[model samples]
Target: MADVETLHAIADAAASLQVLIQDAIEWKRQHLTDDLLSALIAAEDEGDALTADEMGEQVALLYLAGHETTVNLVGNAVLALLRHPDQLELLRRDPGLDAVAMEEFLRFDSPVQMSRRITLDELTLGDKTIEPGAFVVLGLASSNRDPRHFGPSADRLDLGRVDAGDHLSFGGGHHYCLGAALAKLEGQTAVGRLARRFERIELAGEPVYNGRINLRGLASLPLAVG
Candidate 1:
């Protein structure tokens, strides 16, 4: 447990990082380059360039999405594999199952548990009628385990499951995750490489959760690998 002072320090550090990201966005706007930041800065639709604040927000989102989400994805996948040895052994036996295994890992334990959305207009979903501007929170993790979509054994991890890619771990529609492909590649490579390099991998002690309500991942995972 972190003390009040430590919590304050963490908050301050996060604020500082936000400032730095905004500064970088402004810097990139002036000195346009071929990188992602420059591309976002210079992006225009029908000669309508993005506002400075919009650019900053987009850049910040890209940074966090590219870094934290992928870290959590890998961590959650490794933890899931550790918990399910049979699945781990199956993956170890067939390295070619990396892609599908990645999908199962994502479905079994989504890094992002929820997403918030605002109603654009009055909408009726099932029994509930949501008015315009109403706030809606989607439970992505729960959706992944939905028996209607994933069948009766949805709770179980099956690397060979074909419909595992249908999971909403990467979101859907226009607001889908921008770094989805990159994240998947990173996760596949990390899990596959770790399994290939380690003949025996076991948990050294109990894993510690990050304690974040939205993001699910391990704060520290002790592993014994040979």
Candidate 2:
């Protein structure tokens, strides 16, 4: 069936990406004596060392955490702009708003829609008790739309919002994304340039979405620009 093939294709793609990341990490470990790789190597105790397979998995996770997050940021930003004309025009005037704009954009349409975590022990959130081994799925997008955080205009795209970064798009606390700065820079560069150059940029047709609920993004966006 096509469905089974598609599932296999997705798995194959993930596996391929993992291999690529593994290869790069291995190459660097072989050549470079940098602190990051060195630290990873140093973490190994005398009795326990990082096996080849373990190292590969670690490197793969690192690559996805860094690479996939940025890809989503840019893709989601473009989709947001295409849908909101007023915000796009406003951004064209003030290039400096790129940073805040990205924050707002991320809040409005978070690239990674959901995150999962297992409670270490019995925990109480509000009135409910989360038992150990319970899986919790936090909806980042829904939280961004929370009236308490952004007030009544949470759903509205306000580029000049004072505290747009208050959203949990990049998450919070110790688990916060490591490559946040790099991702922000890339988004700012791309969006800022596009704003300055294009006199008129509009979607040519209905944009195709990736159809993955966890990753709300575009597969292909047909746009007309002048």
Candidate 3:
């Protein structure tokens, strides 16, 4: 069937990424000294119970998580600035607000849209009961924009918000995203670079969105810079 073929294609891409991670790890072990690979190897040597396959899985996870999320965060932040001229001007005037600008940008259009978890037991949420084994998709984007939590114009992108740190874009609780700090740093760096370079930037065309509903981000965004 066509659906089966499409799934196979996706799986193949994922497998290829895994292979790339393995190759990168080998390269690091040969070329560089201290890095994520080195840290993982050290942990393995220190009586860590992970098998070879498990170690591969760990590296694969890091590669996928770190690569895709950081890329999306930067891309999404650029897209946001392109859409909002006023916000861009604000950043242009006050360069020191890069950190706050990045946070506000992320909150406005998070690279990661949603994540999943299963109900451990029957838990009531509003009128519905999340039965055990029920797959619950947490909408991080929606939660970030909740009017009750973020005040009146929850959807508005305001860089001046002092408590911008409360956004659920990085998730919450147990799985609060390991690469949160790294993603923020990348966003800050990329946005600062772009702000310094272009006086005005606008979207040239409609952005290409990933078909995946879970891993939401722009696949491509053509921008008109001036």
A best-first ranking of the candidates according to their TM-score comes to: 3, 1, 2
Give the per-residue lDDT of model 3 (tens digit) for 20-115.
777876776667566768888777768898766777898888778888888888887887777777878888888899998888877888778888
lDDT of each: 0.87, 0.81, 0.82
Tens digits of per-residue lDDT, candidate 2, 107-196, equal 988888888888889999899999999999999889999998789999898898888888888777788876777778888898878877
List, residue by residue over 1-226, the lDDT tens digit for candidate 1.
8999999999898778779988876676689867777666556423566776666567677888788888998989998888889988998999899999999999999999999899999998899899999889999999999999999999998998999998998888889988888899999999989988899999999999999988898899999999
Candidate 1 has an lDDT of 0.87
Which ten residues in a row are the worst by lDDT in model 1? Answer: 40-49
> Candidate 3: minimum summed lDDT over ten consecutive residues — where?
25-34
Q: Candidate 1 versus the native: TM-score?
A: 0.86
Error of 1 at 194 (Å): 0.5
